[model samples]
Target: MNSLELGAIGNCSIAALIDGAGTLVWGCFPRMDGDAVFSALLNDARTAHDPRAHDPREGTFSLELVDQLHSDQSYLANSAILRTTLYDHHGGVVEITDFAPRFALYERIYRPPMIVRRIRPVKGRPRLTVRVRPRFDNGGIRPEITRGSNHIRYVSPAQTLRLTTNAPISYLIEERPFLLDRPVDLLLGSDESLQAGIETTARDLFERTWDHWRSWVRSLSIPFEWQDAVIRAAITLKVCNFEETGAIVAALTTSVPEAPETERNWDYRFCWLRDAYFVIHALNRLGVTRTMEDYLRFINDIVEEATEGELRPVYGIARDTAIEEVVVPHLSGYRGFGPVRVGNQAYLQVQNDVYGSVVLASTHAFFDQRLGYPGGNTLFEQLERLGNRAVALFDKPDAGPWELRTIASVHTFSAVMCWAACDRLSKIANRLGMADRASYWRREADRIHTIICEQAWNPDVGSFVSTFGGRDMDATLLLLHEVDFLSADDPRFAATVDCVARTLKVGDYLYRYVAEDDFGKPKTAFVICVFWYIDALAALGRRQEARELFETVLRQRNALGLLSEDIDPRSGELWGNFPQTYSMVGLINCAVRLSRHWEEAF
Candidate 1:
């Protein structure tokens, strides 16, 4: 499938074509950061190395797949039960269901590795075909595959994937298929004895994983309007999260370029500091405290580990700080998107706002009492130190939030976040009875706010500019209300909103930052920024307008309700990164904010 088509089936899949190999592509085995068993999407040639590889061009393999199928991909009402349907071209159909069922006995803190893909051939026999191919270590390492009577075991140095099939199937090194009678069950799991004790242990691990996810989902308190979408997004987000650590990756797949055949492809498997606050906020809203605590712990550990005493913009799921961007010339790029990058070089860029973002997220946790008051006090102290560093370097010209190619003057968004850091620090300190430090932080915050209000606002246009001494409007300013830097009802805020709607709004979508009239590429509207616009409207009491804009934005979500980073306004095609965490966070936050506003109005 094309990237757009594959993205469209994100939530609506009985058997999600995760990787190009047609096996479950983007699932965590022992944990989210564990080696991918199916990574054909990254390297098409890797499929040739596997014992089970299928070529669609060959007439021998006739696979019937549906596109844009009508479906509700959601958690099983209140559980993490994922249901997807397969409609055969010949009127035959099947339901492929999966769930980590909640544990029946004492809840295990660590879930065993297993995913249950239950296929019920509802219609005719339909000539069921089954093939299992397993790759190890992100397609970098190969494993020794040993087949038993009904089970297949793939063993590597660090991990093992045991595949058990109920139906008798023939194995092939090339394009081949085996027919099966009766229902078939396949258990893919990790454990040393998976091959020797495949039957009893495999079933046990599958049940345990299901139960763990189910129990976690049951803790959520979702409103009717957004319960399903929120739960699915949350589960996908969680599944992308590294269980070994609390770090969350941007997406499961890498090298899915922003624009097909362009060099915009990036590796999104690493955790970003910018996503830290949103993850915490989302999980906290769902009443999932353990994950949040774990995430905070991960953050603290990284902060303590930093020898330079400053946070990297991104980190590996394994908490490795060193990420060198490298293009794999050996492997053909995804859909011919040249230069498939494996590691993020942006981590090395000096993004000034990240410090403030980290501080802001931690401070939010403290203020909400998500961390116990006394324990929060200790956390606040750490945040205060970070805030102090931000204040010290507030005026420096580092990369802004967009991480643009050219270095510009002080970005208004970075300045605003700096102000937010100080303001949040002052409030937290005062709340915790640290009167001595409160005055200093409060004064610095006021000074920064005054500077931003004076320098960032463009009087000629009556709106906030992207940077100091600039007149181009920025979508990031929509967050002023979110940080409480400006009252939503303020005339200046309204003027800023109007300016953005007029200049940045291309047709129905919103751009991130308007070019300075000389920049080359004509950028598409950022999907997340447009949602932020809706959030701003909601906060300003434009409930009807906000809802209208929100629904309009929601329509941009491909058939499966998945959003990329940006969209081609003219063609209505998704652009930029696929399944962006930023877009999902924006969607969830807007839904929650609008729901609360609607409830208050009622």
Candidate 2:
């Protein structure tokens, strides 16, 4: 059956999800939010009852061995490149390497929207069939195919894919099995001619990309424990970043259902201010500031374009604001779950935490000398605009962090983040020696904090609730300590954490909440919530329990040490979008907090 066990590879410009058998099951071409050129990930529903249950609309590119028995896949050492080995019945073996070229060229960073595949025989004679089928418009359109002596083009009116390969064009075009006695190079990219031999060019680009990733990994200041896991998570976050426009997409594949037999899937292709803040916070802990710098620039543009200091929760990579959510009825969803959607509707809702998210994400730029472009008075003024919005909306109700579709409530997290916005701006103003402005922001922050302390806490429940004067527990209350709204030593902070754990814990995972919302009760555990629980554990000096829970969550990662947005607590199977940026960021934060110091290890 098709699962999220697939590996993700990308160049920031574009990304693709490769199944264990070395097939491009899901990917969008031209750009991350563009048309789905390879939509098999959502269309294929091969099940045990009927293995042929998958839709016949071809949307995948596969390199299949005639008698394939099993396949193993892994990302090379510390690079984004993935290696998959398929062994046949007669001891025949094939190795397929996949990556999108991302390295320096022409004195500037060179990253293209492309995919490079190298297929070669490793053992005996391996008979293989190369299938290069691509559909556009979310499987609603099949492009015209035109093949040449060396390259074949899949042209859809909207976009064109050029398969520049060294394999026999006839064998590739016709789904015919052939002998793979030697290595073959396939570079699927824009409709352009190759400047050098396909094999030599691919090899050179592969080496350079490998070197670039290794060098980037080496520059990271990783904790002593869980080095491999941290590196993989870091690279995954880097892959999610749309370097061209500095917007980091939430995930690679969208509309992968959050649970079985449910219509809970939503698109994660756009940049969410709240999600991007978590990503940057984790990277900042590891001293990776370039992503923050780029993302800040992206957010800065959004702030500039905001009319009268109003902003939405999401925006397209190129700063497009009118991101309307649409459901494509053509493609069947993952595991037969339908209602595959694109362009999140959350953009149209009021997620008030975003104001504080922007302030917290940009605060590092003001004080960190390592950044190329540091924040100053001008940036502070722009952030004040968001703080004003926060002050106006903090007490009012809209969609909270979870983005409920119906019935607004005064979410405590939203109110606290608004408090955080003013709090951080106070410090920023103080840093700039604007004492009057600092005192202004300080009073604003204190007013909100006092309100939350009085209204958000419930004496009957013996803990703070999810919303003001509400009685239910929420996982976000665990973050009260992390965000510095409440000290770890505070009894209220400890009580809030204890309350969430008692109410939300299921087996080893923690659910976001128990109450029914627009989609009913949350069935799967939001993976990041578990990480936050771990952080809370550590903050409250529950070291042993924190480490144990961190390890338990680590075991829940997919084979590639990657995580999706949510996981089924009962089965521990991954669901929701693939390579979720929030989940990876959570892994990084927990690993950093739990890892022993290098000196202590020695």
Q: After superposition, how far is residue 22 of candidate 2 from its true place, in Å?
A: 0.9
Ten contiguous residues minimizing lDDT sum, candidate 1: 7-16
TM-score of each: 0.85, 0.98
Q: Residue-pair clashes per candidate, as listed?
A: 5, 0
Q: Per-residue lDDT tens digits of candidate 1, residues 1-602?
A: 44543321121111123322123444434544444455445443334554333342221111223332232333344444455555555665555555432343564344446555565566654444454555565555567877777666778887787766564535433324443234445555654334444335435645665666667677776654655667666665565556557787776556766555556677777888877667667767767676677677778887667655577778887788877777766445454444656678878877777777777666656556545422456677677767877787676676777776566568888888888889888888888798988898999999988988898898998898878878877788888888788997788998898898888888878888767422344457778888889988887788899888877877777654667677877788886655677887788877777765436555
Clashes of 2: 0
Q: What is the lDDT of candidate 1?
A: 0.64
Segments in model 2 whose C-alpha atoms lie over 4 Å from true places: 45-57
lDDT of candidate 2 over 100-160, digit per residue (tens): 9999999877888889999989999999999988888877887899999899999987889
Top TM-score prediction, candidate number: 2
Identify the runs in model 1 with alpha carbons over 4 angstroms from their true place. 4-37, 42-81, 87-92, 99-107, 135-144, 155-160, 169-179, 194-215, 370-377, 405-408, 516-522, 596-602
User: Residue 218: error of model 1 in Å?
Assistant: 4.0
